[model samples]
Structure formats: C-alpha cells, structure tokens
Target chain A: MVTIKDVAKAANVSVTVVSKTLNGYSDVNEDTRRKVLKVAEELKYTPNMLAKNLKQKVTKSIALIFSNFERANGKDGVLFQIMSGIYAAAVDFKYEVVIYTRSLSEQQNISYWKFCKDHKIAGAVVTGLKTTDPYFQEIVNSDFPCVVLDTDLASEHTGSVSTDNVGAAKVAVEFLISKNHRKIGMINGHEFAVVSRQRLEGYKAALSEQDIDFDPTIVVNSDYSEESAYELADSYLQEHRDVTAIFFASDLMAIGFMNRCREIGVRIPEDISILGFDDIVLSSYTTPKLSTVRQNFHKLAYQACEQVIHILEKEEKGRHIMMPFKIVDRETIKEL
Target chain B: MVTIKDVAKAANVSVTVVSKTLNGYSDVNEDTRRKVLKVAEELKYTPNMLAKNLKQKVTKSIALIFSNFERANGKDGVLFQIMSGIYAAAVDFKYEVVIYTRSLSEQQNISYWKFCKDHKIAGAVVTGLKTTDPYFQEIVNSDFPCVVLDTDLASEHTGSVSTDNVGAAKVAVEFLISKNHRKIGMINGHEFAVVSRQRLEGYKAALSEQDIDFDPTIVVNSDYSEESAYELADSYLQEHRDVTAIFFASDLMAIGFMNRCREIGVRIPEDISILGFDDIVLSSYTTPKLSTVRQNFHKLAYQACEQVIHILEKEEKGRHIMMPFKIVDRETIKEL
Candidate 1:
C-alpha cells in the first residue's frame, strides 16, 4: 500500500507538512498543499483510518443531498442542470459525488453527522430543501462542510448558492413591459420558499418601476407544480380575460398553462403572451418555445461544489454565491 | 454498540441465524432473514470488522457504476429514469447506493477488484458499458455480484436487464407498415451497442414479416446523437425523397430529424410519417407529440437493483430479464 511517506518523499515535503495538508490545516502554504495533495492523489494514498475505526477520517467524495426528492429525479428541470454542473466539477476536482436524500421522517430519526459518517462523505451540497425542514436546522448547526442551494442560512460553515431570483424576475417582467404589456399577471411559488419571496419582490419592483399598480388579486401563489399552476391559470383566465400576459415563476408551470390554454382554445402570443422562469429543458423544445428568464443552474451547482470543497480544504470561508441569469427570447412573448 | 446478541434477541432468532443472515448465507429462511436484518438495522448493528481488516465482510450498500459517463449527467434521457427507479428501490430495501464512474483511462490503470475494494462497495450495477470494454470482461469473470443493463454476459454472478429492443423495434416498424408505408427508412444507433443490433434485427424482422424488400440505401447509422441524426436526416431527405416514413432507434434522433425537417420545409404526417423509440419525457410534450415505442426505464432500473440485491443475498442465480415495451400512438403518424 502507498503510504504518506511515499507521497511526502515524492513531493519533497516533510511528513508533518503532508499530514497537516491531508487533514485540512490552514497553516500549510497553498503551493505546498497543492503539491502534497497532487502527489498523494497520484500515489493513491487513501488514509485507511477505517482499520482503526470503521468510520473514515477523510475521503475524496462529496454528497448531493436533495429535499423534495422527486425533483432530483426529474431531468427536464433545474435539478438535472445543477447535477450536470456538479458532476463536471467533481470530475475536474478528482472527487466522487454520491446522490442521496434524507426524508422528513429520516431527518427526525438521525443526526446529519451520522449520515455523513456512515457514507464516509467529506462534504455535501444540498438542494430543494425548504426552511421548515428539520434537516435544514441540522445542516445549519452541524460543523460539517456543506453548501445549500436557493436558500440562505448565513452560517460560517455552510455556504449558499442561487440565481439572482429577484433580478431575473424583474428582467422577465420588464421584458413583458417593454413589449407594451401593462395588464400582466404573475404566478408565484409557495410563500415559504426563499425563491418565491425574492421573485415576488422582483415582480412588484418591476410593476412599481413602470408606475403600474401591483394587483394583488391577479397574483396567485402556487406550489411550484404544473397541476396547481394549470388549474390556477384556467380559473384566473376565465375571470381576468383582460390580462394580456402572465409571468410564471417556473417553466413547469408555464408549460402546464400552455397545455391548459390549448384545451381552452386560447392561442399563445396571439391571444395571451406568457413568460416563465428557470428555462428548463422542456421550455426550449415545446412548440412556440417558451420565452423565460434563464437561471444557470449548472453554474449555481458548480459554485456550490467549489465553495464546499474550498471550505473542506480550509482554503476559503463559506460564501453566498448568486449565479448569473438572463432572459431567453423565444416564441412565447409577443409585442402588442 | 449494538451486537449480534441484541439483534438476535429482538428478532427472536438464534445468534447463529442472525450471523448467517447478515453474512448472506442462504440457509436462513426468508422470514427469519428479514426479521434479523430489520432488527439489526433498527439497532444500528453495523459489523465493524474494518478495524480488524480494511475489507468489510458485509455492508448494506450497492454501487451504481455507469459507463459513457455523459449519460449519467443527462436528465432528459432514460438514464435519469433508471436512476430514479434504483434510488426508490434502494430506499425500500435498506441499501445505500453510491454512484461512480470509472473512465477508460482509470479502468486501464487499476484492477476492478482494487477499485471496488477502495470504495468498499459490496456490489454494483453497471449501465451503458460496451461489450468491448476491458472492465466489462473483468466484471464478467470476477466473482463480484453485479447486474448489467442492455447487455447479456450470461455470467453466473451477473444479471442483465433491458427492454426487448428487437421486439419493440418490430412493433414500431410494423405499426408504420400497418399504415400502408412500404418504403420505410430506419436510422439506427451505433452498431457496437447491444440495443442497436437488437433494434436492427427487429426492424429487419418487421420488413421480412411484411415481405417488403429492405433497401440498404435508405438506412443510416447514427451515433445516437441529435446532431448526427439531424445531419443524416438532412442529407438523406435531399437524396431520397421517395422514402415515405422513417423509424429512428431513439427519440433524441427523431426529435433532431423533426427539427431538421422543419428547417427544410418538410412537414410531419403530411409529408412523411415518423416513429421513434425510447419515448422519453419530452416525447409526450413535443409538437404533434411523438408516436413511438415506450420502454419503462424506471421499471428497468428497479429490476436491475432488485436483481443485484438478490444476487448479493445469495438467493438465486443471476437471470437475464427482458422488460416489456409498448407502442405509444399520438399525432406523429398518419395512414398512407
């Protein structure tokens, strides 16, 4: 078996320096740490503390912990894009990522440390978790290295990554306004989600900027699901037929509304313009292709992984990262 | 700190039976095995032989090893569906799954056993691997418990799971033939994939059954990519306009062809009928929706995990399982 001595010799470093570097000590110089770690990895020198204790002290691995687990499985949405970024970054950083989920029931039953210890995970990136989830609190308190997506815990140990939701929402609504759409309605996600609140603020900000009074009656809070958005749009359209355009918080909801519109004989762009957020995979493939605010989930995931790994390596403090977003102009939006 | 005695006592089983059950001895009855394992899990009685030796005797975990590493990150495809199934099944079976990939360079640099031992994965499910891969042969010869997808190794320690690609192909082609289309063109994925060959056989079988002459000029081999398929369709349409319908071995290719057709002024169903395989999530949402063959990738993944676990438990010899497939009809096809 390759030993620390071999790696230290190859890197021309003392065993003490090698040990400190492997254990994530901050005193090691960046150049020396890089040389030592690179040599150790090339030699495949895994610290087999498993022989002394069943739990490993360190491993070149990360975990992607997901809440609302179904999103982890859906490929047509932001989750897949985020995973793509994480996977690419993991390959580049020479780390393996294990995908897992801890349900509400499991959260109450096990400590986050035990979960990570059992899996021998070095660090983690968490996504889709709501603030109310007990696991969220556990993550906030645990000293374990982690980064949460689309939520801000403001912890020293835990980082956060997300799109500039408020800015992206404002851009989407402003695009509609630029197209002379004044009677614009909005469909937002659940109130408890940080993204929903941020997006709502953006919507209101855009309306206020245009001197258009925010119509509370025209805004509907949905559960970020297509079925709920579809039903909401169906009823909202029947009562508020004068609304020229609608802005949805997610592409799934936009797609659902489009499906419902087709059933009700409402033509897209011609009868009513639509705007969506996230620009999920389905958004581009759908007929008349949805025009929406494109949040780069891949960049968000990449930043989260990079931040968590940097924290693990003791190279940087945790950061609150907001990835870039832009508007994708397609067939869904029309000039009145 | 829980021991075999506690688990045995809680489950009303002998310590010997509990040991045998945990160690994967088939002599233990099914009910007794379930009871003992459940009790052991509840008591958190993980065998800590890692202290004595780095190799663990038993672990409640499986490895999902993917080939073609790109597919692992793609959400708009069958890979995601398979992963979803595996994740769900693993949660039910009390097994933690680790997802990993061994690149061709990595495979050549390390022994398969060493790779598994380093990761401490008890068993693995390998998907998207070509038969020519060195790791595939190593897996086939090794005693490690495994289940492979879309390929048959016929190894006693390994099982295979896939839709009846040949049969599904025949059904799809026959559906096109039934609509009075005689000059049918087939676009196939790379020939190295077992699924590609099987689907080819199916296409030929359908033609043979209908007593229609198969023309070599009308067939195109693509690399299972939309870009390749789009280019092939573009060129094929320019040269062979007489071909009334085309059967693409994958939905991605069909979608690519559709996009190309639109660019070149060809109409679907009106100018030519179209058929696709693998009815991905986007298939249902596309314009005129896709008329294609649907393979239940979720069930395919579920069975792969179940088979791998069954092999790990020493319950039965690994079996080659063929999942069912069906033709999904929508607006993409029309009777000639």
Candidate 2:
C-alpha cells in the first residue's frame, strides 16, 4: 500500500524525483536517488510498479513460464540446476523473476501475453518450450525480448541458449563404440523438442561414422520421463534382443529403464550397458552411477540470462548462443 | 502483438467493450463477453495486463517469495511438494505464479516493502516464515492480503495454513515409544523456523507422557539439510552409544543422517533405527525406505491457495487452517 506519494513524502522530495529515482531514469542525481532509496527502505515504502513500469518501459524483471506439464520431479541432472543458474544471474543483475506456470486447477491454462504485459517485464527466459506450441510462438513474435532455453526458435526475434546436444550424443556413442559395443539401442525423446531431434541426429551420425547400421527397429520414442523410458526400453529390448547397450534421451528415462531392467532380472552393465542423457544429480547416486552426456546446464542457464539482459539493453538482439556439452564417465558403462 | 483493438475488431465490439468484457465488468453483456473471448481465442489474443490489472486492482496472480538463503542443493521437502500442489491449483484458478526470493547477497538483509511494492503484486504467499526475518514482521504488518504458509500467525489480519507440527511430532515419538525406544536421538531444524521449535516441543511432550527422560543432549539443531543431518547424526551417534533410534525433522535431513550412517557402517534399523518426517518421494526410494510422519504437502499447498482465494473473496477471513498428517510405516523403523 506504500505508494509513490508516500515514498516522495518519506524522502522529502517531489513525487517525480522518487518515481524517476526508482525507475532507473539516469536523469535523476545519484545523491537524490540514494536518499530516496534509503528513506523508502526505512519507511517500508514500495514504489508503485503500475505507474513506474508503464512510464519507464521496463520492469527489470523476467518471466519464466514453466509448463509443469513436463514431469521434472527429481533432483537430478543439470536441468533444474541450470535453472538455479538463471535465478542466480537474475539476482546478480538486480532483476526479479516472475514464474507463471500451471497451478493445481485443470482450468489454469496461462495467458502468456497478459501475464507478461501485466508484469511489464523487460524480457523473459523461456523454458519447457513445446514444439509447435502456439503460446511459445506468440512470445517469440512479440516485441518483448525473450531468451528461449533448450530450443532454437526463430532467431530473428528471440535469443536462444542451448547446449550442444548433437555433439554430446556423438561423444556418448563414440565412448560406447570404443568399448566394443556394436549393437546399441536408443530410447529416444518424442521428436517434438529440438534437443531430441539434435540428439537423434547425433546418434545417427555417430553410427554412420563407424559403419554401423542405423536400425530404426532399435529406436523407440519416449515422453521424457523415467516411466516412459522404462516402457520404451522394455519394448525396444524385447524386439532387439541382440543389443548390448542402450542410450536414453533423459536421465529419468534412464532411471526408469534401470528400474525395469531390475524388475525383469536384467543386470546393468554386466548384462547390458546403459547410458543416460542430462547427467542429473541422481545419475551419480543411482546403484550403477550412469555414464551419460553432460550439458553444462548451469552455464547454459547463465548465458540465457546474460543474453536476455543484453537483448533488453538493446546491446544485442536475436542471439543464437550455443554452449558446450560433454560426456561424463560414471559407473554405468561397461569395459570392452 | 494482437492487441485489445484486434479482439474488439474481430468480435465486432468497441475497445471499451472488449476491455469491459475482459475485465469482467457488469457494463458488458454476456453475449459480447462470449464473442470477445471466442474471437480472442481464435486469434490467440491475450489481453494487455498493464492496462487491465492496474485498473481492476487484482493480478489474479500470487507471488511466492521463498527464503533464498539456506536452501539445499536439491531434495527440498514440503516446499517442493507444495509447489507441485500450487502448480496444480494455479492451473485450476487460471492465475499466474511469480517466484520471488532474495538474491544470495540480499537474502539475510532484504527490504520486503520495496520488493513487494516494486513487483506490483496484489497478494503474496509468504513461505518459510522465519521469526527473526525482517520480512516476517514486515509481512505481518502489511495491509495487503497474503497467505503465510507453515506458521502459526493466527490473527484477524492474516491467513495462515500449516500442518499441526506439534501433533505430527507427538504422534511420531509416540509411535517410536510404542516400539520401545528409550534413548532416541533427534535432528531438528533451524531455530528461526517455528516448525523446528513446535516439533521439538512435541517430541518432549510425547516423552513426558511416557515418563521418559528428556535429555537435551540427545537433540541436535540442523539447518534441515543432508549435510547438517549427517554432521549431527555422526557426532550424536559417536557420543550416545545407547541411542536405539533417531527422529529427523525432515526427509532430506534423514537421508543425510542415513548417508552418515552408511559411511560409518552402521546398518539402518539394525544398528540405529531412523524415523523421518515429511514423506517425500525420497522416503520411498532411499535405502531402507524411510519411516515417516507424513504431512500431506500437496493438499497443504492446495488448501493454502484455496484459503487465499477465500480470503480474497471476502467470504471468510479464516486465519488458521491445519492440514492432517499421518504416520507412514516403512522399512527404516524397527522394534527397539
């Protein structure tokens, strides 16, 4: 309830001074701004966001509209950790993060534009970008600056930061093949996500280099979860009994695959080597610490935040930034 | 950027009519509102929030301001599950959620009024209400409608929703005493959080009823994390060789204690029994499957949302709401 007027009264300055000082308008004197800020703090005065955001044309905030639809349940991998990085960077830049996602209700389909405009956000860090999602496309086309993560959207309008998915996948295959596993299977993510498509190409590319057959029969599409991986692997393994190793698109799916393997009396690494993508934290703790691709999610998320801020500042625009990825060696892989 | 004008043009209505319709004003007829909604959907027109929210005085959004400091690297309980529930509920209400927390630098020292005012939030859900926290007192004094979680700030001015921490703890200890644990160890939370004190008191109350000695030495204060739990349990076990069982204030802390136990080669249930509070998903997955006092976090979060909505509606100003807790019998417990 502490409005701009109260801030001005507390600071012993005009309302215009308080408003200008609070809005990052460089025209205000630093001494006056500091005095206003100090008094505002003591008085517990909250600047009127509605008035300032409208006039200044910046909230110094970012919107992260998570699709909670993707089941990211566990504390694993760099996925959520990467998110922490964005949070860290935002805080470092003195920006607020507004997270608008699905709550408990079935009717809670979010209105992206309204949420953004209502907040008067300077930019956004887009996550859980579903392929062909109309909402994603809308934000991409908007004048508002946005940084898309894990997806390469239309570069002309949006800044994107992604891990080198294809390179990571290729490294995983090279490691597996180096260990003398020729008949490898892959539990893939649904082709809707750009990362999944990139990973698949990497898998195929690795196979092609080694003169291995690109067997479609060995590939099964999973819906980015442990259970999905379990189901996909269950059927894939059943169909391709000769395969000695399997690569999963996600850590959860890999965990699921491991769970199913245990249920069906299949020994990991000894009976079949399993590799997971996303090297989440759980991968290291799993019974057979998974060998997998590691996307520097923290780096990716940080760069994403950095890029969005740059775009908001108009120092750069529509940047397609790609960070590096690696394959981490854990206990899951078998020796040749 | 499909604006209000586009929606109005498509719906064959004036901009005022579209605004009125979108804002749920009585001036607009139901037929016109329906037409605007339908055409807006067809064109994917999300209303401009800046124009609408300032005038209507409701964001239909809640800001969840968490304590940025003292969070674990991962495996956070109640808060994590509560978020899951909040997500489910927000979906139902069609309200956007904004996540706000102090930056690491500004965490211990924050200006709550400035944070809230700058955000332009109508209402907020304040989680992790630390007693010493400046924000706690600031929020308690604020006239704005807020829902504080996991605290007993039962007053006419604010709405509070939490599990009966004392009751749940008493039940846990009673269950253990029933199993004949005479010298039980405990790892409690930080002193600032009310649940830590409540649960600790409940532990003593249950012991008092059973005519057991309440040795202060048996209790160790942790920040409610695996590392702290590990340290507490490691030292406590070293000192109290007669301790037959250990009770944890949180599942993550219990998991930490278990890890410590593992390092020391003390077998769970056999060497030292463990009882965890908050039946997180980890409880079911951890080695020996943690026996726990289960606070229905999902329901708790859902109820918090519903309570805030109720308070906002002016239907009732119910201040204190307690969700039920249950004892989950799992592998970590044993008869002493």
Candidate 3:
C-alpha cells in the first residue's frame, strides 16, 4: 500500500505540506500544490481511504473525566467500580476511552468542552464534580454530549446517571422505622452534593410517613470522608445519647461510624441500629456486617456511557436516567 | 493556510486525488498529477509540521498492561494504588498512558512487543503475569522496555519493581518466632506467581534460621483469590490442629481465612494467630486489625514508571528495583 511519506518524497515537498494541501487548509501556494500533485500522480500514490473517511466524520472516542482519583489507601470503591463499568462498556461499543483526571483547582481553568474539542472526543462521562463547580456552568451552557455521574445538570446535550438517592434513603430510614426505631439520626455527605440533599429529603419523607417528628439536630453534614464521618459520628453519638439508630449517607461513613462505636463501647443493633448507602465491599466484611442501601454503580456507569454514546450516534438530546436501589438487610439493624 | 480540498476543487479532482498526487502515488495519470500539484502549490498549502514530526519518532506513550482486573468487590488495593501512582508520574513526565487488559489466553496470541509497536508506545508496565506464561518468554527475548510488577525476568530492557517478598516473608515468620509461636503454617498463593515462590523461600529460610526443621506438610497453596483461600484455609485448619499460627501470602486471603476461622469456632490470635502480607486498606479495618507486611505499592509504581521513562528518554537499560516492606503490628498477632 502507498503511504503519505512516499507521496511527500515523490512530490519533493515535506509530508506536512502534502497533508495540508489534501486536508483543505488555506496556506499552500497553487504552483507547489500542482507540482506535488503531478509527482504524486506519476508515483501512483493512493491516499488512505480509511484515514480520509475518519477525517470526514466525528471520531469514535469518548473521555472519562474524573476529579482526583484519590490518594493511595484511600476509599475509592465507587470510583473504581464506575471506571471498570465504563471501560467494559466502551469495549463493547468499540469506542476508544481516554481518561482525563483533573483536580478541582485544575478544573477551574480547564473547560471540559474545550478539552473534548481538542481531543476530538465524541462525548464524555464526567464524575466527582460538585454542582457549584465552575465546570458545571460550562457543562450547562455547552452543547457537548456529556453524561455526568452522581450529578445533574439541565442541558440538551448533557445526560446524568445516578441512583435514586431519595428513594433509597427513604427505604433505609423506613426499614429502621419498621424495626420500631423512631429516634433515628442521619449522617449525610457534603451539602453541595445533590445526592446529599436528596437523601435528606428521603429521610424527612420517611419521618413524615411514620408520623415521627423530624429532628433537625440529629442530622450532621460531613465531607463524605471516612475521617470526617468518624469525627462527626463520634460527636453525634456523644451528644445524642438517646438516639437509637443512625442512617449514614455512605458505606464508608457507616464503617467509620461503626469504628467510632467500637471505640465508645456502643454496640450496634443492641445499643443502636445503623443503615448505610452504597453498600461498599467492606460493608459485608465488617463484623456483624452492615445493613445498607445498595446502588448499582456498574449499571449506572454502563447506562451513562450508553446514554452518551446514544446521543452521539443518534444525534438526539440526552436525558437523566436513574438507577434502582435496594435495601440490604444484614446485622446492622435490630428491632426495638 | 492553503488546503488540499481547495487545491482539489481548483484542479477539478477529489481531495484523495489531490492528496495522492502530492503524496507521490504512482497510480494517478501524469497529466492529473501535474494539475493537482500545480493547484496545491498555487494554494500555498503547508502540511501540519506537528503531525509530520510525530511520524518521525516514537510517541511519548506508555501502556499499563494487566491480566484480569477482577470483577469482585475484593481487595484491588495494590492494583488501584499502582495505577494511581503510574498516572501521577505520567502527568509529571507528560507521557500518555494507555491501558491494555488481556487474560493469559489472550496474551498467548498477542505479542506484547507488537502491541507496543502498533500503539506507538515507547514502553509498558506489566502486572499479573505468571512466570510460566508464554508472554513472559516472549518478553525475555524482546528488547521492548517494560517494568513488570511483582515478577522477575532477566532482560536488559525489562525491569521489575516489587517489595522484597522473600525478606518480607522472612520478617513476618521471624516476628511469629519472636512471639514464641512455633509450629507455624503457611497459606500461599499459586506457585506460578514469583512472589509466592519468594515468600515460600522466605518462610523456609526463617524456620531454618530458628534451627527448626521445615515442615512441608503445613504449607498449603491457594489460587490467591479470597474464596480459594477461604476454602484452603478451612481445610488446612481442620487437618492441621497442631499448627499454632498461620501466615497468609496476601491480605485478602488473610481476611478470608479469618472469616473461615469465625465459622469454624476458632478465635483469632487466641486460638490460632495469623499474619498477612500486603497491608491492604481493609486489613486495618478488619475486626482485629490484621498484622501484616505492608508493600509500598505506590512507591513501587512510581519507581517503575520512572525507570521505564528513563529507559525511553535516556536510552538506559533497566534493572530490578526492590521496594522495602515493613510489618504493621495489629491485633491479629499474639505473643505466644
């Protein structure tokens, strides 16, 4: 097969000049272009049809944009699972997946849309960006095809995939209520996260359903970190001595809270029942185990990638897709 | 900037014709080639210099080749940490990282060297290959730069980074000896893994150092999976009632063994003390907090990436680099 280099050699000009002349750039002089063309014809060099077609259409490439893939020995269960899912899905779709990890600070200066354009990406799957992030504004205004994980933005080209946090949280609290635990406290992640707000709503909805008055003092906000959860749980357990159970927004937090309980000699289920969300792997390994709401992160990721690919392939607007959640009953919950 | 499309239009030929004419194809008629060349020259189209340069040299790209990224919510701690480290280092070096995941069977057909050549990768960091793998034999013969994790092969272009498994295992067994825990047993990963063989050597060395005769009957081989370890440990514990302490080759296996002990009415440390290797994140969170040898996977990864990049940029041959390991004292070990 003939190559671009052969064409350049035959034309007596650089490959770049030949490429520019063929690619519709506006800089080549007509005389040089004519000479190069004449030599290429005499040499019988044929342009690669595949390369030409590739240039004519949008490339089948997607970006998995993450913010801080966590430090080592860090809690990255959900993130890892999601990445695995996206990669697996991309393999099936035959779309190339490129990962771009940017810290929150770096995200301020990097436009996600511009990044996609520069990479010639057809779409992107974004994760770990807060709603208040400047990138969120860029995402909302741009027409780039994007599917965000665990976050929502109203845009024609942007889709979102997250578990039904409100419903899951309600189920978690309701399960505790069924066990006759009315004095249940809530430990939530950062207020900036949309899931946090939705979980809080679910908690309140469960309380109202059970005719139990909502207690604002029992709800503690944390930064979705294990250490923060431990600290917050320690303080909450110290002050709210009467509270019989607590619902944590994440399994990592629940583990931290359980560790705190061990330190304080507070027995799970006997002294207080606990429920968590996103039943991470550690939840099952913990002694007495943990009862929590499970999010289908793999399915969420698959759907997110599927959605973005759909929009790109079909030229259709994107929509939010919610994954189902279920309550996993283990040793963490007990009846009064 | 003059473009090929413009030249093609002016010369009344397709872009491919113009491209082929300038690129030196011998298939085009001499008359048409002359016309296309003249048109391209008149347009003053300069080929892209960056693209041309890219074709002349090896791309600054590296491959993170892995055997299976397991589907379990298991201890992917080392794998995840190493990936994080490699990505971090790649960012500093401005190298692009591509990941290739293929099973041993798939690897039998895919030549690692060819993969790098096809992808234009300068080097690769390989993980999870057994010593007997056919790919390892290929790697031994190929001059492609590679830094393998937890394995050793004698090749100038191939380097390896892993914790001193033999020394670490020796230290672990010696710690048990210091605690007066004689009659120790071992639960090791598959023999195909170089680490497993090293650990076994270290175990025997420790026993020899203590003037104790090595008992081959007490050592059991597992597939390095948590479930496999659980079954193997259960059977081993049931049969070897005389063994007082057991050292697991991996933390996941240790956790599984501990869980098996729970089911079989054996109390950890009090009944049969256990020590584990690879202080995974969950090791610290386990009920009794596992006492294990900590592999600095992050550092190993950083060093591996650095070494491969050095070989690529400086044209230096690679060498094996061993990372240090330390024992983390926790509740799992009891002084006999």
Candidate 4:
C-alpha cells in the first residue's frame, strides 16, 4: 500500500520529483533519481500502471486478439507456438500482453477499436481473422495500429505478416512433379482462408508449368479440420484413382487423409505420394512421417509483434511482411 | 475523442450525473441514467477502464501467470486448452484477463505481489509452478488472492486446483495389474513437480494394494520431455528386461518411449504393455494410440479462475479444489 507520497517523504523530495525520477525523466538529477529509487525499493512502493497510463495518455501494453482461438484445442500446436513467439518479443520489448478471444460472430456486438481504447492498448496483433469478418473491415478502414497474421489487409496503420504460401506450395508441388508424378491432386483448406486460395493458385501454377492439366474435379476443400479431411478422403480417393500424388494445404488435413488411407489399406507413397504444408509437430510422428512445407509460426508471430510495436513507435510504416518457408522431405513422398 | 463532459452537455446534465450513470451507480434517477447512456452511445464514447480503475480503487482484471509457457510450443495443447477455459470463464464473469509469462529465475527481480499491484490485478491464476520455486513460497505466505494449478500450496488468500492425480494414477496402474502384469516399471516426470510426486505415490499405492512389492530401481525419472524420455527409454529397457509393463507420468514421455521402442525393435503390448498419464491430443494420433489417464485441464483452469474471483468477491474462502480425472482406454495396453 506504499504510495508515491511515501516514497517522496522517505527520500526527502517532492512528489513531482519522485514521479519524474520513477518515470525515468532525464530532467531529474542522477543522484536524486538514485536516492528516490532506493527509497521506493525500501518502501516496496509499486507504481500503479493504470493511473500512470491515464495521466500519460499512453500504455505500454498490446492486445493479442485471436479469433476462434478455441480451435487450438485438439488441433495442431500452431496457435500455441504463435503465442510463445509473441510473448518472447513482448518480453524483449518490455511490453505487457493482454489476450482477447473473439469468435467471428462476436463482432456484431463488440468493436475491436473500442476494445483497444477501453483497455488502453497501444497496439494489437490479431490472428485467425477472415477478410469477410466485420472486425476485419473495421481494422482495415480504421487508423488504429494493428498487425494481422496470414491476411493481405494493409492500411495506414494496419500491417500483416504471413508465410509465402504461394511460393512454398508451388515448390512442394514441383518437388512431387520432379519425382515423376504428373497427376497431382490437391486437398485445400477452407475457401474463405486467404492462404488456401494462395496455395491453390500455387498448385495450379506448378501443374501448368509441368504440362499437367489442372483438374478441378480432383481438387477438394475441407474446413481446415482433421475430421473434415478424413471424411473427404474416402470419396476423393474413390473418384480420383489415377492421381499419382496429392498436395494438402495443412499438416492436420494431411494427417487426417493419411489416417483414412490407412483404414482403407492405401499404402502411402507406394499407391500415392502425399505432401503437406505447415509442418506441425504431428507431421514428424505420423506413421510414414510426412513431407511438408515448414512455416515458422514463431517467427511470423514475432514479426507481427515487432511490426505493431514499430508502427506504434512511429519507426516504420505499416505494410505486409512475408516470412520464409521451407519444404521438408520425409517418408510420405516417393519417386516413381 | 468524446468525453464525459461532451456527453453531459449533449444530455443537458451535469458531468457528475453522467459519470455516476455510466458507472452504474444506483443513486442516479432511472430516466436520467437512460438519457446519459443514450447520449454517450450517440457520441461514441468508450469509458477509459484505466481511469475508471484508478478512481474506483478496484480493477475487474486478473493475471494468468504461466511459468515456462514457452514449453507449449511443439507439445500437446494442454496449455492452450487451459487458456481457452480461463478466457471463457473471464468472459462470463465480465473480467479482463492479462497474460504474464515468468520463468523461475525471474522471481528474483520481480515479485508476483508487486506485479499484481502495479497492474491493478484483482486476482491471479498461476500454472506450471514447482513447489520449490521462490514464487511458490511467496504465494503461500502472502495475502494476495491467487489460485495455483497442480500444487498443494493453499492459504487464507491462496487457492489451488488440480486433478486427483494419486487416485487417477492408482486406477491406471491397477488396470495394468488386472491384466496380469507383475513386473511393472514407471517413468515419472521432474522430481520438483508436485504432480510427479503425487502420481509416484499413486503408483506405489496401487502396487501395495495388489500385494506387489514396489521396486524403486525400476522407476526412472525424466524431465517430462519427449527427448529425455526417448533417451531414457533405451537404457531403462536394456536394464529391465523382465518388466512386463510401464506407466508414464505424461503423454509426451509416453510418446517418446514409444518412439524409442519402435527404433529399438521392441513391440508394444505384445512384448510389453504401456500406460500413460495426461491424455493429450497426441495420444489419440500415436502409432497404436495411447491408453492414458485424462485430466481435464480446461475444467481445472476454469475452476481456478472461478476460485480466484470468488476469493476476490468475498464469496468463498480460498481452498484447494480437486477436479475429477478419467481413464481413457486406447491401444497402448494389452493383457500379458
């Protein structure tokens, strides 16, 4: 319960002097600052950040607004990895992180801008936001400082960070083609997701370049869920028996497809080769392992934090930042 | 920016009336309160929570202090599920949740009490703390409202929530015993963790109940890491050739043991049965799946938040809460 007044009295200084010294103002004498800090430590006086933020009209805090964060459970560890990266960067920058989970439907009643204002958030890093969401439009049109993940939205104060989905997908498909598999199919994620569309485009580009006609009938879409992919796998396999290989938009979907293939006695790589994207941890543990494009979610989240902080500090303009991706060869793919 | 003064002026009311109305003070007349709210909405005014907290001397905010949260990456989604539960309860209770990641070493420089004070945190729910940690002692001795996860420390102001590890472990081991396995070994997690100790006790209790002598030499310890378990598995298997079954303290360790078993040409269930604790998402996807005990991390975290909030609101005395656990049967175990 020790206050600034107590620290001032103990240090034989005025409250203003104590405040300036504690707030790290250069106007305070070095000796006086040292004495004030010593007294404050002895008194165990902790400054109230709420009052300080109110008085200074600034807060050294950011909100990590995650849409559909509940999906993190029973799924891959992508969101958790992103959270770790965000926290690491927040620690380095000495900023506090507040987490807010919002479903897509919640935007009708809540505004992200007002949430930031009420919480005194200096900036925000949002993920899992679709372009069609009401909050996405609000963020795109507003001047509030924000960094989005895996989205193409950018504005005067809104930036984005994501892996080069198109290029990575193309490289993966090309690798499959190099293995003498010309009849390649695709299992894409939700059509609403930007990365899904980008990956699909890459699939087509790789097919056209290799003189393999792009077959729309062989392409399937899942809701980025393992169960959905599992359900789609049986029918997709039955209809496309000539497809020599298949590219999956995510590791989770690939895992689901593999599970179904196992049940139906379809041997991986022997019957059909499989390639996956977003090399989640499970990719390494699957029965035949998995060949995947590894996107560093940690780096993506770290850069998103840095981008928002940079925008808030006026050190950089908001813009899209594409992180690097790597294609990892494992047991799932086979040469003809 | 819209202010209280603007709302008051537009509503033809005084600033004090506007403030009182917005703050939900019952002293304001109903019609006046409605008028103030309507004007505030029209003006697009969002109340500054920082300033309101400073004036009210109470904050509707809680901190989720996670020790070694970085371990969440590339691992199971236990932490993420806990986070989801905490957020869900926070929303229901109308409280804001702020995340704080602290390593054991960080306590020397930062005190939890000071952190809660500075951030105006009404209470806190901390997870992944060891009994030997400096912060554990602080929580035990301090009067600050807190809820610790998976620890026995509880005080007049500090509560705790965890699964009934001893009972759950005993049940799992007893099931293995029922399968006619006499020579059973165990791979426990870090010795510093309370759950590890509790589960070890449970393992011993099950042995005693079944009239089987406990063998300390066969019980090895890992750091609850897959790599550590994988390394330990080779030596343990080589030395304890007579062991018919093994119980693991965590699913991650179990998976590691399974991986090592696969590499060393040791067939699971046929050669030796395996049981694990903490049925994480990976348990369902492993080669033979994993028969394990399931602790509801989501429920534990939700109850921890509720406990802390209850203590803060003077609705309940801080005490330890033991949640139920389940035994999940998969493909990892078999009759000897």
Give RMSD to native, each candidate: 6.0, 4.5, 10.0, 1.7
Task: Give the per-residue lDDT digits (tens) of candidate 4, residues A1-336.
Answer: 788999999999999999998777899999999999999889989887777888888899888987765665647888888988888888889998888877767777878787777678899999888878889888987778999999877788999999988888899899999999988999998898899999998889898998889889988888778888899988899999999899999999899999999999999989999999998888888889999999999989999999899988975778999999999999999999
lDDT tens digits, residue span B283-312, model 2: 765666789999887788877777766666
Q: Per-residue CA lDDT of candidate 3, range A39-111, in tens? A: 7767656564335434564656688887766631446377677867887788779776767787777777656
Best by lDDT: 4
Q: How does candidate 1 fare on TM-score?
A: 0.86
In model 4, residue pairs whose N, Cα or C atoms come closer than 3 Å (at least 3 residues apart or on different chains), thus clashing, are: none
Q: Which tens-of-lDDT digit does each residue in B50-110 have in candidate 4?
A: 7778888889988998777666554788888888778888888999888887776788788
Query: Model 1, range A1-336, lDDT digits (tens) per residue?
Result: 676788989999998899899888999999999999899888878655454245544777789988644655484556766766787778789887878888888888877777776666789999888889888888887888899999766576788988898988888899899999999998889988999999999999999999999999898899888878888767889989889999999888889999999888999989999999888878888888999888888888988998889888874667788878989899998899
What lDDT does each candidate get? 0.84, 0.77, 0.81, 0.88
Ranking of predictions according to TM-score: 4, 1, 3, 2
Q: Residues B25-58, candidate 1: write the lDDT tens digits.
A: 9898998898888888888876544442466446
**What is the C-alpha local distance difference test score of candidate 1?**
0.84
- Ten residues in a row with the worst lDDT in model 2 chain A? A101-110
For candidate 4, give the docking quality class from DockQ: medium
